[model samples]
Target: MTPPVPPARLLVVDDDKGILPVIERVARALGFDVQFRDNGREAIDGLEELDPDVALVDLQMPGLNGLDVLRAMRDADPDCRVILMTGNPTIDTAVQAVQGGALDYLEKPFDFDRLRRLLAGVRDGIERREALLQADASVAQRVEFHGMIGRSPEMQQVFDAITRYAPHVRTVLVTGETGTGKELVAKALHAVGRRHARRFLTVNCSAVVETLFESELFGHVRGAFTGASDTKVGVFEHADGGTLFLDEVGELPLTLQPKLLRAVENGEVQRVGSLDTRKVDVSVIAATNRDLKADAGAGRFRSDLYYRLSIIEIHLPPLRDRREDIPYLTAAFVREFAARVGRPITGVTTAAELLLQRAPWPGNVRELRNVVERACILSDGRMLTDRDLASAMAISGQAAASAPPMLPFDEADDADPNLLSTVQRDQIQRVLLDTGGNKAKAARVLGVSRRSLYRWIERLHLEA
Candidate 1:
């Protein structure tokens, strides 16, 4: 089953009669189960009873002001995201609300698109905070490899595949790009399988020199080579009666393919510089970033070996491919690095998350980790500001720190942009610029049908 959104319980508090239904409609549309309150007193009572993931309050409320409501809500639970809403907002008020521990402040006549963006950032912040708590192994293991983070159906399918293959003592092949955590999947399979108690030895095929591959996989007798002073067992012997982890298996040389295939077929090994053939029982788990079949067809790898290793195969989606997992993973990484580095960096600020979601992370999770670590080191206190993230991302020409967006709102017409519309505008503009006015090229660049791009162009109002 897919994981539900972490923040289902939400309370919307505003004094104006018009505010309640709009808040309710927006919150409900965003899949939040919302409770509405007319003023601060009712909001406090509702918050105490409901204990929501977030509380949206108006700064000007009858009796106990919005600040009072925020103070009360936070005093009850410091974690709840309290966003202050106001019309005719001022710089002084924004500073006060932020300093007073409000998650963020939104202007009146909600920018639904911006509001949605804020909620996403709030969810990310909550994840990062929780991840920090989880980083304490003593606390609990909150992040797991299979279906632990994302709500997408693809991830659920991957989870199901892992569950199905975790039991048997067969060799499994895991294929994925770097930073997708193929090793994590291997470990999970071993941990969840019947061989949980046995050793899980890992060997990086690419790290081994061509001459040392055999010696590393099979035991080397004394005087096997210049460096072999004494008898040393190889990974196969060491992992006997257990599991052997072969990372970057696609890097294994063609000359050793026959030997590896032999070992797998016979369940035994032959020591180097010795006429000894030893019988050893071991299960193999292999991981690779290359297309093994293509490599085999190109004579880079052995087809027979590929089939043997791939009795069960699992492909992990890249971080960008599984965009739903970024917030979860980014949150986890931030918490972990902050605690390790002894920084109170509690969460990524709203602008930081916007930059993250908008960028194309070519380097995947590893790059994200580095960014989080850099942010952790640069951050001063409990939150990671947009500035902390800016230098690390290397997006060469980022926008100015703070400026009103170019898109003007029609407040008089009640035309608030939604996420889909915002995305369409962004896509159209991005593709148009990339294609240099060639609509066909723009459609291909966007991975959308030409007709779809044309429709988007018409909808978003384009110059090209």
Candidate 2:
């Protein structure tokens, strides 16, 4: 059942006590829960407690004028709509009011009709935004595809491609930026494919050492290398008649490309330091954040291997390009984290949703999920306000700001450390410890890629 929308809050700060009654009547008629302050000082003091959706302040006050109240209100709640009123109006003060983030400036002598219209407009806007948020919450539940929630046309296309190719494709490539859920898409393909009942193995190509690439993909005979103490069955053999998801495949060593290509092409793999070739029927799903085509053009990757892996390519769009999906994603994340934490957080307020929609989600869905998770943890009420989301985003921004410059993990130790680097190191260590040395869980909590977390661990010289 849908809950009733709360009344829009309106705060009126005017020195004249006589005008308070007039404003209250009009505001209450517009369905506003109204509060009155005799001066700006009192308004500013109570601003945090009232947390009004709209504020009407008189320009002329003894101390801390309307402009002062507006600034305080903005600092307290940026989403609040402010309207300034004054009897002795000037062009300069009017300009200052507008520039100070006033929704509108009104001349006094009480144009009751104009005031009524303004109040009604604010009420209608608040109600409309509330309605949209409710609609988004409903749509979020309906538009889920597998574990991913998106209604954007780009995501819809990707879903269609997965449905069409999963049943038959042998080799597929999923491409997108980090945190765009390439791995999820790979899992979705495997789940719907003919090999659904078989083992679905995943190998993070970047995480594996270059020397172990061949042995990891194709089994190694005992005594093949210094650490080849036993004849180990590789992923290719273990996942025979199943799916092998190679994440960050662009990070695979150039020397091993031919062997990988052969495994994809002829379903054949040769164990390291062995003469015989083993035929294994394994479906490969390769995912990478880098453009393999561009890398091939630059001679950084083999063209033949790239072509073999990209028989059916699926590209996932970034979150910024799909802004319309932000609300739905937020709703889903809120519900998920709230349930996981056993909180009663119904959803984010309309203002909070607006803030999320405007955010530049560089980390894409993962970053959004992290923020929502953090907000859910911080919130103690049924609805998450803008303040909750803002605090979470601020923490994220601080961590991002303290991050060291991007360098290869192998060379990270050589870079000089600074104060910001120290802060980042401490934060990573704390999260790692909190997650009990689980790099994957820490990465999700920190809103970073596992590869990035690994690099930070190396760069910061942490025990994890």
Candidate 3:
């Protein structure tokens, strides 16, 4: 059973009493939950409380104007779309309103058709945003691939490669930075490959003991070594007629590389302390974070082994290079962590979203997941705010330096009356300078709205 969609909330602010009735009528007809404000000052004051999806304001009003209210709304809730309507409309005023983030401007003696069309468009946009948010909620579990969630062009290319190569490839080499999900690709290959019904085994080359490396890769006979209490079958034999995933393959010892190459090239393995070679039909998928080509050239890795593995190689792009995917990734992580913690966290605040965008994710997707999990654990409400995420990031010791600097406490300490203000002012100034006077970007860096940024600029007497 599908749930009924909620109506879009609309706020109408106008000094003219005549305009109020018409707005109420049109808004109600459009299925909007409408609120009316007689003055711009009241609308500005109630902006945060109303949290409207769309706001319609009069151009000129007493005490405050529509432009001022629009600016205030933009700061308090950047998601809201605003339209300015006026009796004395001009081309210059329309330009100013649009430039100030007004979605559209209207003249007096309103055209009902135009107004209906505009309202319908706004409603459609609202529906789309709501749909995206709902989709994000299920993204953690409904990922297209094997726990892999991405829609970027780079990831699309990877998906295409996986689709094309999975069905036919035997020995595939997956290369990417740590946490770029190389193992996932290996699983994908096996899942889609002809050996889907057979066993898929994983062996971490870096995790295995140096002495036990040979025994781990190939079966060992009784009394093979010091720990030979019983004859044991290795991962290769266990995954016969299936796929064997070698994680961190670059970490495999140079001396053992020749044996691994022989096993991969020929479907055969020689057990330790035995001259007999047993044939096993197994597909090999090797993953590494290191540049095996460079290692092979430098005489650290076997060139023949490298060449064999390079026959089918898939490289994953770093998270930094796919910044556009961060929003989707963040949403998925938020949903996953929220469910894990039994919280009702829906999403992040706009300012927090901006902070995430500005962050330098050196650790890739794994790091982002950890950060989101920490934030979810710390969050107490439906939405994760900038402060909650900041606290979580502070624990990592990375956000404190890379993310926007938090301002001083509201209360001034008696020991340093002006010190706090001085530091706060300096931080704000530095961020503004770094953004080259881009108030929107600077506000995002400082985790504040544009209106709040304006207030700080005025209060601190700082120039753009």
Candidate 4:
């Protein structure tokens, strides 16, 4: 469900009890959690306590003028939105108020309509700032599997497939986009298999230089090449009677695919400088982000080798496809990062959670983990807020600090349904973006059911 926005904090300062009641009523109706003070002195004292989003101050007050309080607030928190009111409105006062960073100025008896509009504007400004912060909050609840967490049906299927095939499969192909936890799946397959106690080594095909591909996988004797100073067992030989994880398998040079195919098929590997072939019993687990079948068809990858490696294929879903699992993933990340950084962060604010849920997560779980870890490192409070998140994420070029402008809300009494839907769609999009495109979270924030959200998405053609 979409979480509710935090109430805007309001500090009202006025000596007139008559005016205070009206302002309090207005603030309450606008969904503000308010704090009141009769004099400027009291208001200044309350500033530290309330830490308000918008402050309503009478220009002329006992003990301290409204301007004094404004300056104090500016000194304390320049972000606090302020509004100045006075019975004797002057051009000088108005000019001074704006210079003082007051959002709006009012005189004498307030125009109830103007007052409502002004307060509403202030309320919106607060919500927008909160949304910005919420989107950035990084701490989450912890749920995981060998340093991973996923509960979506797609992820569960991947988990089930791992368990089902690990004990029996000879060569398993794990394929997915980068950051989808392919290596973890590879580890899980090894850990759950009968060879759990045996050595499990990983070789990143992309990381190795092209010339060293054969030597790295099959070993090379001393003086085999300019850099081969000593005889060393290669990955295949080192993982004998265990498992060999070939990551980024698509990057394996086509020239070396034949040699790798021969090793996997016959359990035989030959040293680079020797003629003798050594027999090794090793399970090969190949992972790739690329579509090897398509590559093979395109003649970039060997079709015969692709067929051998993909005898048992397990595809991992991208983070976007499994939006249902974000919360679990977030919680797990929060816990993991908190422990690593020795921070007492327990969870993320609702705004923060919604923002995290809506992200596209182009980098997948690994990106999410790194984001949370960065947030943990930067956090000061026990709970993570949007500000902490925004600060961390902004470094990556995401506009996490500024909230998107809200759609216009004031419309005719008999507004067009289509027009209303457009507004609704805008709101949904904002919420979805804040939640990182998590439909369930978006629905909750929009106060609609998941089924309703889906219908809206279909009708509106929402990117969600």
lDDT for model 2 comes to 0.81
**N/CA/C clash count, model 4:** 18
Error of 3 at 175 (Å): 1.0
lDDT of 1: 0.72
lDDT for each residue of candidate 1 in 208-286, tens digit (9 for 90 to 100)? 9999889999979999899899998888999887888899999998888888887787887888888988998888889
lDDT of 2 by residue, 279-341 (tens): 999999999999899999999999999998987899999987886667667777888899999
TM-score against truth, every candidate: 0.55, 0.57, 0.58, 0.56
Query: In order, how many clashes per candidate?
Result: 1, 0, 0, 18
Model 3 Cα lDDT, one tens digit per residue, 1-464: 12344467899998887877787788889899998898988887666456577998888998789899989888766767898998998889899998999999988879878888889899988767655544543442222466686655677678778889988878999999998889989998898889999999999999989889999999799998987988989889999999999999999998889999998999889989888999988999999999999999999899999999989999999887776566667787887888899988877776676666667767778887888899999988887877887887777664533554333322111111111223455567888889777665676777754444554676556897
- Minimum summed lDDT over a 10-residue window in model 4 is located at 407-416
Instruction: State the lDDT of candidate 4 residue by residue for 1-464, as single tens digits.
Output: 23343467888888887787787788899988888888887777656456577888889987899999888877656667788999998899899999988888988698888888988998787666555443432221212355556656687678778879999998999999989999999999999899999999999999999998899999999999898899978999999999999999999998999999999999989999989999999999999999999999999999999999999999998987776666566666777788888888776665666566666777888877777788888889876777777665665444442332332221111122222222355577788899776554565566654434554666556787
- The numbered model that scores best in TM-score is 3
Better of 1 and 2 by TM-score: 2
Tell me how many residue pairs clash in candidate 1: 1
Which parts of model 2 are misplaced by more than 4 Å? 1-142, 398-464
